[model samples]
Target chain A: MTMFTRSDKVSETGGGAKPPARDDTPAPAEAKRPQATAQPLSHTAPPPPPKAAASTVSVISKALKITGQLESTEDIQIDGMVDGDVRGVSVTVGGDAKIKGTVYGEEVKLSGTVDGKIEAQRVVLTSTAHMSGDVVHQNIKIEAGAFINGHCRPDFGKPESKALPPPHKPAAAPPEQKRDAVVGAP
Target chain B: MSALSLSSLVKPPRRDDAEELPVSHLGRALTVRGVLDTEGEIRVHGKVLGRINADCLVLDTGGLVEGDIVARDVRVSGRLNGRIFALHVTLDSSADITGRVFHHTLTMAKGARVEGRMPWRPLNYFETLEQLPETRQ
Candidate 1:
């Protein structure tokens, strides 16, 4: 009797009810109505401008200088100087780029100079690339004219226990670990 | 306007005026924490948690900025929780600002929601401003 009346009210109000599973949970359903009404009151007010800025490919142009950290869920193309760490999905360091901190990404391509470390799944050092720190990558490509003064290790995403040993060698050694993986077939 | 005032507002003294500075874009999914000093234009579609010094700054519709902004021209269509010191300021319809805007010229759209004061300073005020005034309010 009273149950039928309450359900009819719920349906007629907005028809937004979840089909009650057992018909025995009338108290909880009634409680949801107050919250639903509260929503409209706030919705009528100025809406919060869409939250944080959109995440698209961020481009740091040649004239810009960032002195702090930069984090992105998308790609980043840097043509400027960054003093702090940069974490992105795909980081592309352009010809005149200079990064003083660590760079973490899925794909890191360098054509400029990086003073810190690079940890990525795939790393590409172009002809003009000048890297002075260590690079930890799963698959890496170093062009003929690229200048790398640091250790290049193929240990990205590997468990820490097995990642022991720096494999430090002479500057002439050409990232044998990753070359071995290529021959072993990644 | 006096010749002194016109020169101050018409053009800001920037390094390498003959060079065409490229535009930098910070996409929506990016979050930058630190000082970004640039000579060119910067479009922020992402969140910036630190101070920004740029020639021109555009905060797109979905962006949220939380620090002081020092720029020549500032256009906001997003949310800003910090102060702005600029020669020219334009607030779009979707702008939701909480801090003060110190500018020489300000144009605010009808639907913009501003909570703090919009103080208008002379053109020379921006040119001579070496540092932003400390936040007292």
Candidate 2:
């Protein structure tokens, strides 16, 4: 039979998953600027900056079954099972939904169970979510009681390539001392 | 590149009303019944019985449904042993559907298999294909 549950109630086990490592370290000069020029603590008034507010339009109820590839330009919610690939701007998997294929979206929130890989800009695994595949995203958050297995990699907008390090080179010694010994004929 | 940054700024304001997020897996101890009417999209990965009326209905691979479905667009990638009526029906390469399907457009990808017949009518189709001559008497 079919059952519907929210995305925040999937009872998954295990600890949280950490994000992947970065190769290059940002320059220290740029990092120190914020700390060097500290503003005085002001409790009186602070104007808000222009914020980028996100919009959400529709919701998915608990009674849909999709088997083939489903692609959309708008945000989507899944409360049922999907057997094929799914691509959307944003996706939310409810606690009662079961996803068996890959998911490609900008933002993905999981409170249920996903058996395949997930690729998104931002991914959040709630306390009730269960994931069993790799996650490739720029940002990732795992809440308590979530069960996740596999690798987590950062999304830098470039295809990840396996490159080896450059060959080592020994440092050369100074040339003045050798020239002085030859001129002295000692 | 700088002008592209302004595109987001000129975009419309955010809406407080948001869509519902999807639920990955179904509850272990719950039974679903009756009809599910949705305007957007719905995917079922668990067992579903009865009628489902929606815009788009997807049955993911490995999902099972033992009922009838009526929708504008219907797709199956898993296993379905029920009746289906839609404007367009597509079966992915891995789908295994046993029930009859009535649609204006039907597409079955390679590796997909169906064991039912498609009975055409002047105006409408039956809820279950079992009432047809090929399935029953």
Candidate 3:
């Protein structure tokens, strides 16, 4: 009998036996509530001025003499003297580099002198390089005339670009005609 | 307090039993309280008032950090007002840093503003020659 009365009251209030409507207002859905996500929030403020975009930046290391650490996120060329640590994504030590500190990078190309450690994904020592430190790289390449006095353990399985000859250029003139012209002109 | 007995009362745990546990949020956020040594990338989107040490650090656009940062690769596209020590560093066009920056490779975009010293400058014939004309006059 009480259950029947409760059902009568529920039917009198609303169609379902859930809850009586208050002020006849529709409640918000629970799933439609705000929730936080992993994405960062965006502000509705005015946008700032546009800035320049630098896809590639190069450092030509020449006669620069550095006493402290040197680092970068792009390609680097070391043709100077560095007293402290050096690091980059891609590092190229010219024949004139006289680095006395450790080197860290993704890929390192050496043609200079280093007295400290060389750690990278891959390392390449050219004929002119005179290294006197330990090397820690997944891949290593030593040229024929390269001089290295460092410990080497080549893993040979790393994602790094190797040294290759510059791209060849096509002949501007016909080979036979150029040869004939050279033979006649001289 | 009464006299304590060594054998009757339980002693503190031994050093061997205590593990060398790291803080869960060590390398996350702009935590300036402890060392932020990481083997992965760290992005700073807020302010840091103290020292920061990491493997690689990337400051996204609109990020503002103020402290000392030490890392292997440090790239900034925001504002920094502190010292930076890294193996390499890149200041994008949106960067506005004011402090000393020490690195092996240092690059700044066209619109980037930096007030610090560059430790090394490799040979750039064009840049060198460009300065020659001004110095000669």
Candidate 4:
């Protein structure tokens, strides 16, 4: 009989009892909630900035100096001095930059000084560019004020067949053609 | 600005222009196999297979360094496989380091994984660190 009476009372007060029970429980739950949320917030807050900074283009600023090779699948902007080879997809050599070794890239834009060779599909030498070595490219553009002291060859894709013919033919062909014309006239 | 001024005061008098030097960023797809020397700050997000000498070095997440680091302030959120000689070292939660850290002051987050000894030294130890001891290579 007592159990049956308690069951009836529980059913009658179920809706009314839950609110007070929740009110009593929330005092402790609210305290634990902030601590739980704060822990994760502190742990997760510091990593996003570094991750975002990492995904962008690399900048070798003017204050830095690298003494070896730098290989990148992405773009590289160099404003410093590099004593070794640089390989990138799109390479921008700033006006104050200096490279002592070879530069290999898909597209190379030079406004600085490259003491070594540049091997790329497309090469652009701006007004401030000072190139001292050979440049092998498929398409090349030399600005008016650019200084190039070496050969600029358009043989970029095929290296073997075209490499040996250009230098020898320009030097040897004119005299041979003149002698042949004179002998044929006589 | 105040922090910069404070750090400048605390640092040595040799590099007064350290705060004005621009930070160098090594992006994720880049791989450098040489010595990176800077007077300012360097943030490495790629792979560096050589030594780094900087005023401040931040090894960001996903970055991997496989050599020695000599810096004044070192903050690591990436993976390192070499020794560190710094005055102040802060290891974030995502840092996975596997070498010795010779630091004057060290702060490590909860989830950082370090697998070598961290020996604390006096402040003068870092000041006089002109040449690294050749006993341990």
Candidate 5:
């Protein structure tokens, strides 16, 4: 998925796995500065394309610890300890992870401990999840063994819209309004 | 030059461990504000504003890191505004660093712009650097 990655996420893009037409271009095997090699080739000089190798996913390794806010447009996989708020598109709290502040995301999958609130469109609390605050989600899948000490709210968008008629409308507006709500609330 | 460096003292070396562990890459669009500690290599293409402790750190061009870095091997190609404590350090041509660099061995490309003191330490100094020096406010 090319959700929120940049054009040159991986250095290997300078070498192999290029398109058939790009093979003739002279690319450095390990291009330290990819833009320098990429700029001269295309005469039109179109913006560099973001390939599959250019992963924008940020991984918080198990040994890491953060004490400040983390905001990202791309996916974030946290396996360490965080003492502040996290905002991302897909925020995954790994099994040993511990987040001590609010988490805002489109999809939040938790398998560890969260001492603060969670606001997301879709929330999945795995068996290892230990939540200590309120959870706001539109669609929830809580495993049987999950531990939660917060109020689960199904309202993430227009609160009155949940009671509105037209069940087929659930397909289109929930996501659009949820994004707006998240932006407005913050 | 190699005799007094930590690279000669450490048997396996930091780059050797990088091949064995899982490397984490942060693309240019990401921004982080916190502490990152890992045994593996970390390639930063984004912006980081906090402390980073890794075996090897490679800051790519256009990347920016603001804070302290404690690693065995540090390679900077972008901009950095913090202290660095590493056994071996390499500043590329595009590097723009403004802080202290405590290293046992160093290599600077022709065009690297460094605005700080590079204090050379012994291998034992790096081995015993469990905590970074307190920064002046």
Candidate 6:
């Protein structure tokens, strides 16, 4: 009888302790609950990747027509019509492209029609290129079938003494000096 | 650069035609200070200080636009200091806009900061828009 009673007391205590221990397990579950909530917050963090994946090169597609200045510190690929000046690090003009204004770049590859001048450090005119204006470059390569109407001068990065001075001094100084002479004589 | 002719700018491409056209991407290091006219889509991640005419336009995060935008669909997740004239407009949570948004349909997220009026218009109104009206303010 004593053995049966003692075993019942021990079993009762063990059963009583198990309920509190089960209650204590909820503390860690509550911690896990916050982690579950954090997963949704992490889902929100993925939106920046698309923005980060934006291309570094600027592309002007064939259907586009720009009528102002385009200046870029990176590469530019043009496949459309541009009525404005284009300045870039590396400029590539596609075969169907048409540019009316000057193109300034460190490296320029042309396979299109350009009506204005090209000023570049390195210039390459592909077989399909049709250039109407002068090309000023430090280094140049022209394919056999490329059509060019103007001279190609290897004068890029050279001092502006010959090219710049004539327009600035002669054009400006003559008008001013003549006006001053007339005024002083009067 | 030659001036952008109003006749060329007035003709907005149809939605079906724009879908077949390629998308133009203006990168973060680029700065355009003139008119951008496109029959297709344009995604701007840099700074544009002039008018833009496109079928669809997306101003990505960190992009800055300071002029008028005329498009069929315009989505903004960046900063815009000018007006937008579009049929469909969606302003993301990170958008910071300070000009009027004239659209036929508009969706604005919770955190979007808009300091101007959003006037709803009819579908035909956008289709018949020949030129952008002058800003009275």
lDDT of 5 by residue, B1-111 (tens): 011232332444444444555556677777888777666667788899998877678887888999988777688888999998876677877899999898866766668
Model 6: lDDT of residue A108: 97
DockQ, candidate no. 2: 0.03
Q: Which wins on lDDT, candidate 5 or candidate 6? A: 6
Worst ten in a row by lDDT for model 1 chain B: B1-10
lDDT of 5 by residue, A1-186 (tens): 453354455535744566653543424322433443243321111112223255678887665566788888989998877889999999999998999999999999999999999999999999999999999899999998999998998877646554776677787888999999999997
List the pairs of residues colliding in candidate 4. none
Interface RMSD of 6: 7.0
Best model per DockQ: 4
lDDT of 4 by residue, A115-147 (tens): 999999999999999999999999999999999
DockQ of 3: 0.02
Question: What is the interface root-mean-square deviation of candidate 5?
Answer: 10.3
Instruction: Give the CAPRI class of candidate 2.
Output: incorrect
Candidate 3 TM-score versus the reference: 0.35
Q: Categorize the docking of model 6.
A: acceptable
Worst 10 residues of 2 chain B by lDDT: B1-10
> Where does candidate 5 chain A have its weakest 10-residue lDDT segment?
A41-50
Give the range of the ten consecutive residues with the poorest summed lDDT in model 3 chain A. A37-46
Assess every candidate by TM-score. 0.71, 0.40, 0.35, 0.73, 0.66, 0.73
**Tens digits of per-residue lDDT for model 3 on B57-132?**
6765665667767555577887888877654576776898898776545656668888876555232321242244
Model 2 lDDT per residue over A26-137, tens place: 2443353344324232111111111222223334455455555555566677766666676777889889878888988899999998999899999999999999999999
Fraction of true interface contacts that also occur in model 4? 0.68
* TM-score winner between candidates 2 and 4: 4
Stretches > 4 Å off in candidate 4: A1-53, A161-186, B1-16, B134-137
Encode model 1's per-residue lDDT on B22-109: one tens digit a residue: 7788998899999888866788888999988876788889888999887776889989999998876878779999999998666666
Candidate 3 lDDT over residue span A1-186, tens digit each: 999999888777766544454323233221221221111321111111223342233333342344556555556666656667876778888898788888888899999999998988889999999999888888889999988886885533443334222232234346778899999998
Candidate 3 global lDDT: 0.57
What is the full ranking by lDDT, best candidate first? 6, 4, 1, 5, 2, 3
